[model samples]
Target: MGMNSVNTNAGAMIALQNLNTTNKDLGVTQARINTGLKIANAKDNGAIWAIAQNQRAESTSLNAVVSSLQRGQSVADVAMSAGSAISDILVQMKEKVLAATEAGLTTASKQALSDEYTALRNQIDTIANNATFDGVNLISSTTVNSASIKAIANADASATIDIAHANLSKTNTAIAATLSGLTGTVSAGDVTKLETAIQNVSSQLSKLGTGAKALDTHLTNVMKLQDTLDAGVGNLVDADLAKESAKLQALQTKQQLGVQALSIANQSSGILLGLFR
Candidate 1:
């Protein structure tokens, strides 16, 4: 209470307390600057940290969902492209079959036409078998009910998007079976068979187009969701570097002033030594 006694220096106590407070403030500012996060740990703010952590987890899990969707898209695209090629080949085969059925055609011409048609028909099986992505084929299968491709639609694995297989090969489809029975001398019924094959190929193409579109739409939605989650996490944890920088400068200045104040306080007892002289 009095400058007369060196036993207790009140000014030094106050200055040291202020210096300690400034040091603590400086530490917090430095941490924010170093990490670029205001809530780097639970000690900064537990509730915000927890919320950001959850959002970060969700954003990370969406990476797997994106991979699944992309794989499904590739499979669908391969199937779609192969199916289109098959359709074109079917059209060409139909032209050969029609020419073979002409009334004036010689046996050699008819056999030549049949050979071309057979070659085109055989290509369908090759294309279908090769239409695969990531080891999954959507257009070729020996069984009546081929396994459908499924992709995860959400981060939690609770939902999925399913793409059904379209059997387009000689061993599975009725159109292929009908064409397999053709001879060198094509009949009017052969035209009918090609027509039916065209329609069936068109139908399968439509289905594949629909599935590909659906996958694209869902992928867009999932990507948007991931961006939103990332932004949410940023809002909860990201530091305003500009503000932190300003605060850091202010705290540094305060820290220097605090050290000077403590030095002045510590000299107070020495000043009383002049009284004894």
Candidate 2:
């Protein structure tokens, strides 16, 4: 317990220990600054890290849901566009049929009206058959059996939104048959059939519009949820750069002071040589 023993300098030992602790703390602050994360890994805070990781997974899964919803929206949009075109053509066909019904019409004039009506009718089938998006057709006869576009609605894939199909091409066949052999005339029945077809197309368009709207609304919600989850994860793991920067400056100063203190403790042993002199 001598105050000035060269072999057992307690003061020096205590100073070295304090300096080592300061170095350790400085290293931790530097790491936080470098990574911009207070909890960069499980070693930082195992429980909080685990929770953030789980939330990150959910956010990633929501990306898939957004993609599915977007694809469904595109399919619905294409179908609705084609349905609207068909509706317009149906109106034109009705006009032709009505004109053909007029009295004292010349044979040539009747044939001309019938030809225009048939062409418009054919266009409806063409548009419906071609209305496809990402290989999904909501208004095509080929997809009538499957008859719906389905999209994932949630991160867990537990929920879904389905947009039903409308087979305009197949329905057009009835109109075609009704007006067959219309070289010089159109019957009252043909006009009635065309009117019904036009109404059906309108209803189908309304349904498609609703389904597209659902997709848009759901996509927006999912995006918002992803943003919120991302913010939550950030709260759990992200570092406060401003705080860490301040801590780093303070620790650096403390480390320098610790080195100076240790040096002073070592020099204290040199004072014993002065007594011998």
Candidate 3:
């Protein structure tokens, strides 16, 4: 226990302790630099790591939500495009129906117009059936009845954005069967009915447009939420490389100084030998 005892080197013990401390600090700095993260594991900061892990999970879930929204948006866009095409076809049909109403039309001429109108009507049905995305057709009755597109609004799946299908089938009352019974002879009531059908097609287009807009807004929101979660995770775990680099240099210097001090402490015994000589 004596301070001057030759067998017990107190100065060396103190220097060794300091060197161990410096080595520990240097290891920590090196690990941070290598990983680019201050909180790489729960051992670094348990609470922060837990929060960052949760945020990462939520961000991953948001990716699936964005995908769902995109699919829904595609279906809505296809339906809208089909509706617009149908609208154009209906206008052509109306013109043909008007031509049939003319006074001196030959039987062959009337039949030709009726045939063209029928072809156009059948085209509308074909377009509706084909306006599908990922097997979900918003305009077809058979598919629309079974399609209920819903997007997740949260990681827990507790909330959702629902998109209802719009049935634009030729048989649907919304667009009534005005062209189904058309013949060589056109009536005033048929003209009126065609006018109503045009209005219904317009209404369906407006509805589809509204739904598309809603989907776009939801997609934007999902992207923003994902960005926010990413930022949160970065704040929790990301390291400041510049700061850690500076610490690394400082620790290296301290480690060298510790080694030199330990060498000097061990040499104190040599000084005692010199006194005896």
Candidate 4:
């Protein structure tokens, strides 16, 4: 430990330790700048990295939920559009029935009105059968109960938004069969049935509109939640580029100073040899 002893160089050991410390700090700063992440791995910050990983997984699962909701919304929209079209046809059929009920109508006119009425009723059945989206027909009895669409709200699949099926088929006796068997000889009963069919169609429309709105609201909320999750992950792992850049410059200067100090320390042993001479 003597100042002039060549056996042990304390100044050189101290300088070498400082240089190693500066190199380690420089490596850390360079890694942060290169990766753009303060906690790129669990080694950087184990608890924060684990939390960010879980949030990222949740965000990915929510994307799947959004996709399912979108598909369900599309099917609902198709069914609603078909229901509206059928309602318009029913109104026309009602007008034709009223015309046929007039006292002085000829047989030919009554037959013509009956044919038109039958055609309109058939069109309603056709619309119900064809109101499909992605092979899912909400208005068809065959497909209505086949599957219920659900939107997963969590990564664990414990929470969800359920969308029920709507069956408007003639065979289901929901809305399509309400206007069945109407001919040109319109009875008071036939007019009553037509009124009831109109009301049923209107009710179905309201239900569909409500379901669509609920889906839209759910989608909006899920999207907002996804944004929040992404922000949380960023807060946990993302690096500050400006801060890292400044730190890198400072570490580089410190490394150069360490090298100079180590060089000066190594020359101390040479100075001892000179003293002996």
Candidate 5:
């Protein structure tokens, strides 16, 4: 072969060897640092990276669902506590009326009791009106959170959490003039009127209890769904540390072998150099 041909052949061979060593070392270094066989897009490993990326997107979406569910839980808790307090006041009101049934309560005392009953009702209304979370009130209105997240490249996903407060209306007991024992000619048959008012209050109390129980049910479901989402996210994107560590060890060994192979290739080039001399 001519000098130019030999020189060209040697250069091409050396370049190919260098390229091989460089690619091998690059693979090892990437595996060591990333601890992943595929660090970049799906093009690197079409099947594996594609699955990983899809799983990662699903995990991200589930995380958002969990967060929204958590917020829904908070709203439900506050509503539950406030409802309990209102129920307590209603029980106290019943006790007061029972006390008046035997003891001759003065008109002024009856008026005072009525005023307190009204105040308690107003307080419940206030709680329902003002119970807000992050500038949104759940007790007063049914809020549906259209919480959305763009986790996938070309797909849109959103979730809605319905926040509904239990019915907080008071079980009102209408005042019977006879119950007050005021000097007004309320007919004897009006005794049944007082009983009816108390009955109305009791019936309403039962309805409110049912409503509160339903709200509690919603809260339970929210908690369960949140836990499920958390578990799903963990399964999707969370790294398996033990597996990654094993891969790291293998990559380190590959790196050392790549370096030694490169040295052998350089020695082969030196043999060609001896022929020229």
Candidate 6:
């Protein structure tokens, strides 16, 4: 009985050790699931985890660039919106002038009409001045928003994405003043100067339109690159829960068998001790 009791104690100890081992393994598997990541730390998959970290940094930077691009687009859109209103005013002014030329209109009526046109032109200038986002006036500043951003990697894997131009020409208040003087002042030289200002505005609008288009195309590309980077990051660190779950079951089975084997060993020790009788 004594020998058998010794065998049972030995078997219990062995069984306890196996239980501890399986408990540790299950704990690790559970951690993987809770975190939703495969390489939870560098110790898991050193090389791949490191690469995944670098990709995350790159993704963060790309997100910043996307924000900048969005602001720039808003500025361009404001300009386009203001331009439409200004164009309508200009058309009205041209009609009024034609009507005055055909009929014998009072000078006061013409002057009043001219004053309203001037006011409308000034309003356009105000719109351009105020169209800003996060303190960066894309329409009014000379700062180049079109920058090339590279993905973060061990070796600079240069993937150049050129952002859209800021369309900075709308900041000039002088153009508004010059264009406004065209209808109200009514001098031969003033008419010529005003026509020249109108032409200048037209040219600027053309350039800005082109810049807006460029930025739009770049924005689309940025979104595509973002998606690609996300996929790569997922590949590096994302866990496979299905596989891990299967492994957990297998380990549990083995742990149970180990306990049975240990119990048998302890019983053998008990039998040997019986010889003392």
User: Number of clashes in every candidate structure?
Assistant: 0, 0, 0, 0, 0, 3
TM-scores of the models, in the given order?
0.95, 0.93, 0.93, 0.89, 0.55, 0.71
Best by TM-score: 1
Q: Candidate 6 on 10-108: residue-level lDDT in tens?
A: 656867788788878877888877887888789998999899888888776777667666666766666656555554554555454444343455777
What's the ranking of the predictions by lDDT, best on top?
A: 1, 2, 3, 4, 6, 5
RMSD of each: 1.9, 2.0, 2.0, 2.3, 7.5, 5.8
Candidate rank order under TM-score: 1, 2, 3, 4, 6, 5
TM-score of 3: 0.93
- For candidate 1, give the lDDT of residue 252: 96
Q: TM-score of model 1 relative to the true fold?
A: 0.95
Q: After superposition, how far is residue 214 of candidate 3 from its true place, in Å?
A: 1.3
Better of 4 and 6 by lDDT: 4
In the range 1-277, model 2's lDDT, one tens digit per residue, is 5656888888889999999999998888899889999999999899999999999999999999999999998888888888888888888888888888888888888888878877887787788888888777888787443268889999888999988877777464545445643565567887898788777778878988998999999999999999999999999999999998999999999999999999999998898899888
Each model's lDDT comes to 0.86, 0.84, 0.83, 0.79, 0.50, 0.60
Give per-residue CA lDDT, model 5, range 1-277, as digits (tens). Answer: 5354433455446556665765675565555357433345555556755666665565555555545545555555555565556556556555545444435667777666666655654565566556555554433433442121111111133434343334443323343222343233334344455455445444544544454454456446645654655555455444565766776577666556666765665565456667677
Compute the lDDT for candidate 5: 0.50
Question: Which runs of model 6 end up more than 4 angstroms from their true locations?
Answer: 1-24, 138-199
RMSD of 4: 2.3
Best model per lDDT: 1
Candidate 5's TM-score reads 0.55
Q: Candidate 6 at residue 164, lDDT? A: 35
